[model samples]
Target: MRTADTEPEPASDHDGQHFVVRLLDAWYVACQSRQLRQRPISRRIFNTPIVLFRGSDGRPAALLDRCAHRNAPLSLGTCQDGALECPYHGWLFGTDGGCQGIPALCGSQPGRGHRVPRFETQEQQGFVWVYARADVEPKTTPFVFPHVDEPAYATVRYQATSPGTLHANLENILDVPHTAYLHRGLFRGVERNKVTATVRRFAKHAEAEFVGEPVPKGLLGRILAPRGGTVVHFDRFVLPSIAQVDYALGENHVIATTALTPTRDDEVVLNSVITFKTVMPRILIQPLLVPIGKRVLAQDRAMLKAQLQRIQDFGKEQFVSTEVDLLGPHIWRLLRQAARNVPEPQETTPDLPAVFENTVELMA
Candidate 1:
């Protein structure tokens, strides 16, 4: 059996916390095409703010965001060949974030003092990802969908950031019971009572299987929820922080990863990516398919964001946990643990691969 103390402590009760060290990875809401088109997008990557700009030669550059001369946001400046021009003093920094030119002073050479710190960055799957701490690197490869990765998936991403918590959103999807009620007309139809499910966990991940029904209970009930083989859905919490969702929607096996990086104490920006595996040839149907997928995705995001805001405004009240709340509470615990991923100011980046909580300990 488990008690409250044995489970990971909530961030709300933890005395001090930082975002960078807590999560193993962070995803930037970047558009590779859009990023390359004009000026770079200026976004805060977790606790550390950063400036990204494309040079005249069209190479992407990332700087520590603060100008070398003074602590000013360099993103508010212009771009030269692989360099960022600081708006504050008009100091131009190269792709490596080295100060290239100082407009005010005539310099014999751009001294070492003119350089700004740089971070590790990768532009993939039409987004940019930044690693704040220099020493850390990814253990497993980032999830890239072959279908989307194909030069075909016609993707256009838009982000809506709110003052919501990361754990709150992850719980929404992992908690399948909510999907029946919340996304009734959308993700699923009206009748959900036909589907029977049971959940199991491993290491830091938890999964639920629709063991009973593959057919639906309503008009389409028998078609979707037949006398069930199992449809497995597992969620793994990859530490400092990352979440993986694997589920099958008919012929489509979908996997989505959302890395929740903290921007501020009360807010976390989710960098979510989805990959689909389908037997259908994507070329002919992709134009129509991507939009359908995007619409469904948009619906889920709305539910999560709105529910989070509501809880913030009204404040949390105590709830009686039940057998049905099993998957939801179990998920809440794991995500809360990950949300504490930021490293402490004094600690060095951890050498170990991201750790997962003991699921048996949780469910016991």
Candidate 2:
């Protein structure tokens, strides 16, 4: 229950610099655990190239993609015996990025000054996370989905790349009204119901609760809730870049939590975990769940690509907002302040009038 007040401040700028580095000191989803293989895999995060490989004991390891000797890509090299051998000069490097052997010289020095930069990496919740700054430890734990480990809940994992900024896609997932149009038939029914949502912001997180939403008439509705009843939905955002949605119908609840990380200046990698509790065995249900989840994400991916294209063509964003834009503005402000290493203004007044219940009407 740590509020923004207790959260550590973002990394401070050095040498009189004003802006704090955005990804430094944060843990970002580098790739799914399954994506790593016996061969080294190259991944780029925060616009920096990194290579991931498995050690001799099969533990995950990561390092800067470049070899210190010739600046060749270490990812093209071979991995064996918990060490990576550079393809160019047959220089073998251990899991710690230390030079271990040199094929060319029998008595070559294997120690000092011949090493590549290494990064801190951890595998959790089916994803491998890379800490952006080698000097800073992650302050937050990687997100985990509820019921993922429970025997009664069926879980489906998915990954997608969006041609949009981290801010853009984060806002898209929490946006409720967009589903009726952008994801029609797939997520929402043709019928438009006036839904009300109450939004509140805390120190490090924010949430929107939707009330008066009728049972959806789409395919998802039939799968999640056949007998129509009032649906309780919550859209939430956590610090850094985590967005999740929960749909509750009586005792059964379906949840999808997505962790987004910036792979480039204009692109983000999405790692999603979808889980639900049901009477049926998960083995029978997972096959049906995967396809539907993929379809919904496909629609979102397409829409975000189009939006990014529009921004590129116009050279800037032309946008307007109403009170219903409950979370977008807040998210933008948080990013802006974090970039400058400034404290959140609302952190001091947790019970401010604006932080309390307020509702917005939208068609769902």
Candidate 3:
């Protein structure tokens, strides 16, 4: 029943020594809205355990998974009349993490001092988002997926978890060169046509626009762009963790946006929304696109797993970037600066020339 203006104050004793404190200030999707019913579910984000459930009011709530009474996981307990009951000792807790009743007290009210830490929750774009930092109010809202619910577009949504760090997963999502080799016949072939990429970097964002690119000579291209008049491509990254790729061919357009959430240092969950506006009908396009999308995601997942394993074996990341490695370096720098709570120096002003703009030629 708490409105945005009357939100609860943050807990004072919550853990604040996370590896990336600034990253914790942002919102991350905990689960799809349809996934959370009355049953409690557990998720680990930023290496912190959390439990999510819906109250009797049909609103979602998030709290630390542990119970204050005996340190038992609350996710294992059951829901009763909008409150969570601890299975070990039957301690009833409300959405606000307040102790509602103690079974042993025989209808006596529980002490106000007994409570669990709670995180702010918001439902947007059919997903449940949780603010990671329980000790501070959220600075911003969740990132919105583009072109959602538009009448002209047909949308497909799915999630995949990769055995790689959050940065690695995000970098892979926006990297275009890997698609030619890794996806091979499924997505693109090794035609190696010279392409020009114009890259730009901002305070909390970065993007690359590709030109002079040849039409993809793959099964996907054949199906999506049969005529293939002209192709326009762009890859963009937003701070915290979001990557988007857009493709426009003639009158058809496709946009793929991914939001990355870290479950641990070496694990990440990707929630992706693929939207396209084409001449094809929704009924036919959705059925064909879903399987093809799954196949492409499976390939990326496997490669990411292999990359993580090699990095683990080598003890660290050894990466070399060339001119065509457009967005990887920029993404890393932005994340590093945000982790340290340092602002990127602004080099461009009204009187000065553009700060970072370059064109690189590469074969794809």
Best by TM-score: 3
lDDT of 1: 0.53
Q: Which of candidates 1 and 3 is the stronger one according to lDDT?
A: 3
* Estimated TM-score for each candidate: 0.69, 0.87, 0.90
Query: Which portions of model 1 show Cα errors greater than 4 Å?
Result: 1-8, 12-33, 55-59, 134-147, 150-163, 194-206, 215-245, 249-252, 256-262, 266-274, 277-323, 326-364
lDDT of each: 0.53, 0.76, 0.81
Stretches of candidate 2 off by over 4 Å are 1-21, 279-285, 346-357
Order of all candidates by TM-score, from best down to worst? 3, 2, 1
Candidate 1 lowest-lDDT run of ten: 355-364
Assess the local accuracy of residue 325 in candidate 3 as a C-alpha lDDT between 0 and 100.
75
How far out, in Å, is residue 283 in model 3?
Answer: 2.7
Clashing pairs in 2: 56-82
| All candidates in order of lDDT, best leading | 3, 2, 1
Question: How many clashes in candidate 2?
Answer: 1
Off by over 4 Å in 3: 1-22, 347-355
